[model samples]
Target: MSTIAKEIESTMELNPGIPIKVLQDLIQKKYQVHISLKKIFRAKVLATKKVQSDFTTQYLLLRDYCAELLRSNRDTTVTIEVEREFNPTTESRQFKRIYICYGCLKVGFKQRGGEVLGLDGCFMKGPFPRQILTAVGVYGNNGIYPVAFAIVEAESSSSWTWFLQCLGNDLDLNIRSNFTFLSDRKKGIIPAIKKVYPSIEHRYCPRHIHENMKIKWRSNMFKNMLWKAGGQSVMDYSTMYDMAANGIEGGIPESWVDEVYWLSTWKKVNENTIDPINGKEMWTPSACPTSLLPPEHHTQIGRPKKARKKSVEELSQKINTGGKMTRKGKAVTCQVCKQKGHNKRGCKERGPSTSTQPTSQQQ
Candidate 1:
């Protein structure tokens, strides 16, 4: 036998449970051959199991060898696979029942003071550019968290209702009682919210209200009024009605009556107030009053209009084209006269007719 094998045999005989490390040292010393402790242990365990037919003794010996090997080679890796058997009928029923209960619980939770705010706008290109809807919430704690979302075409009242109803269904929200929604004063949003939660407190944001204000009153006076009204202590419907009738500073412009009408009727009840939990005041105009209704009572109006369109055509007309009407080409014909020979003003045909009927005396 090779010197290494003889050394291993002698080491095993001397100490039946010799640690793998000591066995390795003995083999190296006796045979001048180096071998890892892991190989030695594996070989010994396999040999013992084959020779020893007693199941209990073999199991105990293997367990002890494995424990010693693990201690000596702490960094060694081992892989294990697990298998389980289940009854198909029993598992299917349990899973389905759990899902149904979860859905019901979700609806109940949302119904109990979970307010949802939804907003959306169109994109530049898509099969249905107007179909996107994003939903968020103003939690009781006054923090915003996105809850549900969707995309769809058409922003009609019916379409909005369908979207909200579907969202409630998907989220398992208590669609009838749990939702209070705020959205732009688009024709569809109010009716949709009312249909779902008639008694739920739905208020608009003040930022949107000021935007509508700017559109109605281009003057600084209305801007100032918006600031003051926002700060008022009591923003009851009557107070808003009076403010709208008299204008922000009591100088109502004829052009802004319709805007004022909406403000009085549809503006959110709350304008500006500090959040009770966060202690952060809501957004308000610069001229908002110091003592006013609480933040929770205020609401906003329609979303602010987009910035006014700049007139590029008018701007081009005012620009100087470097005194060149046509670069490297014949002079252009006049569009009005459709003549190529001369410019419109310089055309002979365009001038007053030179021939005149003779007066009787001249004849």
Candidate 2:
């Protein structure tokens, strides 16, 4: 095989979903050899076959993976669920879902982190299509601590409920109102949280709610009023609401204003607590007047915005190079649903399926 072909194969194996153009650019930059898109596409096809084959094997080996995890980590928890349908032609059970929570991570979270939890779902852009549902906690040191994670077929009520249930069991939660959860108000999340943590506080990210409102009320005045409502105390929130409801040319919707009030109420309950991670006083829901909240609403309509900054590898490569890196246009085809103008992470195709079965748990 040619040197460029070898590099392409290696890169594809390392990052299965890398774009053809990205591969072409890297080869030309590193080896100073300009390869045609046709050749790159052919290499990608070969890489895709390898990726799919590996995923098939991975599904079959999931049982072993769970066993190995349990063996390596005492008191670790793991669960795997398979599709119910009988694939008579393949004569194999299809992969459905899996959850993992190491004992050390669970213990560290309980000891060092605050009661608040942040939950979100990310799309996995690999040979095996799935969503990784993650539960993270905030430490007193203002660090994000991983609590648990689940790989599910999609981010639906059933999947979220199962993940939370597993997390609750692993953490030995008391099923009380002490625990607070912050998340974007995704479709299945509210119902799922109610089911698993009915009494616990579930807070929506304010930024998300604003995006939904901006579509209808794009005025700068409306935007300022909405932000004021979020940052204010209960009394101030009501005053801001009145300004938006009555002051704006086209009054803010009663429904949207009401929801913001509800979110502020969620913040009012947080209390000040000692930061176990830092050994200093840290803002809990009660004491911290200004806690960072998640966004208000997630439309889940288009390519999801990147929540993180560039990595060290990316920054290092661009440091001395005089050439500038151009970002791709916002418009692109989604790899997940094969739709235009959206990326894989924001694909709207995977709605909550009615066929999702009950969640399974193992310790």
| Number of backbone-clashing residue pairs for each candidate, in the order shown | 19, 14
lDDT (tens digit, per residue) of candidate 2 on 1-363: 344555676677656757789988987898887789988888778766765666665555555555556655667798876666554455445557789987767766655535788999987655555689999876443457677899887899999988988888887775675788899989989999998878899888767776677678867688789888777743344565667678664344444443322433324323222122211123122221222211121234456455555532343353433586544434588887888887876777866547568877986
Tens-digit lDDT string for candidate 1 (99-204): 0112222333344334455455342121112234556644333545444444333455765676666555656456456555666677777788778657666767
The reply for model 1, stretches above 4 Å from the true place, is: 1-118, 139-143, 170-179, 219-221, 224-363
Model 2, position 142, has a per-residue lDDT of 46
Model 1, residue 215: displacement in angstroms?
3.3
Measured with C-alpha atoms, the lDDT of residue 214 in candidate 1 is 62
lDDT of 1: 0.46
Error of 2 at 272 (Å): 24
